[model samples]
Target: MSEKVTVLVAGSWGTALASVLADNGLQVTVWARSEEQVAEMNQQHTNTKYLPDAVLSTQITATSDLAAAMDGTKAVVIVAPSKAMRQVCSDLKPYYHPDMLCIHATKGFETKTLKRMSTVISEELGCLESDVVVLSGPSHAEEVVKRLPTTVVVASHNAKAAAAAQSLFMNEDYFRVYTNLDLVGVELAGALKNIIALGAGMVDGLGFGDNAKAALLTRGLAEMVRVGSEMGANPLTFSGLAGIGDLMVTASSQHSRNWRAGYMLGQGKSLDEVMASMNMVVEGIRTTEAARDISLKYNVQMPIAEQLYHVLFEQSDPRTAVETLMGRNPKNEMEVMKLETWQQWHS
Candidate 1:
């Protein structure tokens, strides 16, 4: 009866979630790549580099040894960045077993293969893609570590896996977890919204009024639903927490790395300078590229994402990108939403 829970990587989100599990009275182990981070988490009971304000629970420990961290754990939470996901999962492959419930909080796609995080994890773990659960929403690690009220979703094609994830992270007071069977929808919503958040930040950085941001969010959601539905995701999921809810928070908050990075970009900084200053992975940079490819593959119209790709990669001016988007031929909003019907939700 191995009930041990382990969180791979000691990043902000991973440490924050480890805190939740530790608070729940579960013995949690956080695996770190740096021995110094591991020693800091174990000795100082603080992860000052990532989470400076809070002290970690004694129930949680960390290790640099991959095998030692993963040994005999029934539940494993992988929170590596998208760029490191495959390699991290590959590193975990030998220690992986069929019985482990692999729940991943990593958002964004593997741009190289244009595969979802679940697809990457399942391939490395030799498990069904449905066996990997995706945890996402507007939850920021900074607030989540402070025990602030936050809600998120855990989606999997496997009901029991989703249920187990719901049970593992749901906090009665501060953190709320919802279960969704639409794995595709949850992943896409979580990944795609970052691109919109980047645009929202650029709007703010450009000193555009709320009117512009509101329009961006509204239309951004439409684009999210448009691409998601094309990829076999339910349109209604966009209306829920993973979609609009996550979009609002990411777009508005300074705590969001993507938004902050975009703000720098809008302030006339080069992409390299923005990346160098953030000292963190701004997921939108990579996601914008991945989403562009996804849209082209699906043959869907994603004007916003398209412009963002150019602005980010092609060195197109931010103002010019906005103008390009504004100049596009108009189509009726509803006419574009070819879902079964938007009327069903209102009925």
Candidate 2:
């Protein structure tokens, strides 16, 4: 019998990850609230609404019953959106038990509490925060579902749990997984990049050239490093896959919902219009909101994020936001970050 692994929720990312686990010879059980959706996946082996283009593996199954889904599972992959994470984990609390490796693939933080996904999972499940592994990187579900070459990082303070996740998801042919010990950096980088992606999209929407987008990404990364460093993360983590790599893909890719939403906003659509048009959850929108709170709390200067927040919430014009960013006081580009965490590495 194949080892059982449960994936909570049936969104695009969750369903895509389910395919990966099934490909690894695990019995992938997905828990979704919709019974009709569950029946379709179990009977037809496809998730038409989320992943209409790809056919899911036969080894994968779906259920509406949480207890049945979690039963006898060796690992649980939490892929719910940031908004629903706390409640989803709370619902799973009854089924959570020791020795079942808990890994969360959600990228954004809880908007109300500002807690990381892993922390939210641990609190709800009553496990040590370190026990929950964070799975993140440049990989997008649209590409990963098609078995395209994708790399992701599984991070945790628990080396053993991280290695278990890497072993469970790593596929030499298409899916590659690496383990990291820096949990904060991994999670923060994954979440913070979305804010920049929103900015990138707005820049594109405003007809800003490649030079503008490239500069946004580079400076956005600097902001990420600065805040992440202040929050006790290794500043170098932003230089790794979960940082620059993910930022590059999310900010520039046509498949990114955040980028698409920002593009519409830049083209002069309101947030309401963009939200209505986007049938899917744009994680970047919520992440942008959370980033604003984080920047204020950390006392960090995140000009792009602040401007994007204003454009997104305060109804500031996208073009005006761009102009504001461009008109900021000049600084030494190389010495601007003032990052002390990474500086200690050289000394």
Best by TM-score: 2
Segments in model 2 whose C-alpha atoms lie over 4 Å from true places: 335-339, 345-347
How many residue pairs clash in model 2?
0
TM-score of each: 0.96, 0.98
Q: Candidate 1 on 1-347: residue-level lDDT in tens? A: 32589998999999999999987778899999898999999999999988889899999999999999888787999999999999999999999998889999987999978899999999998999988899999899999989999999999999999999999999998999999999998999999999999999998887877998898898999999888888878888988999999999999999999999888888888888888888678888999999999988988888999998998998989989888888889878775456464544345
Q: For each candidate in the order shown, give its overall lDDT on alpha carbons.
A: 0.90, 0.91
1-347 per-residue lDDT for model 2 (tens digits)? 98999999999999999999999999999999999999999999889888888899999989999999999999999999999999999999999997899999988989988888888888889999988899999988989999999999999999999999999999998999989999999999999999999899989998998999999999999889888888877877888999998998999988898899999999999999999998789998998888889988978889998999999899999999989999999888864355466677457
lDDT winner: 2
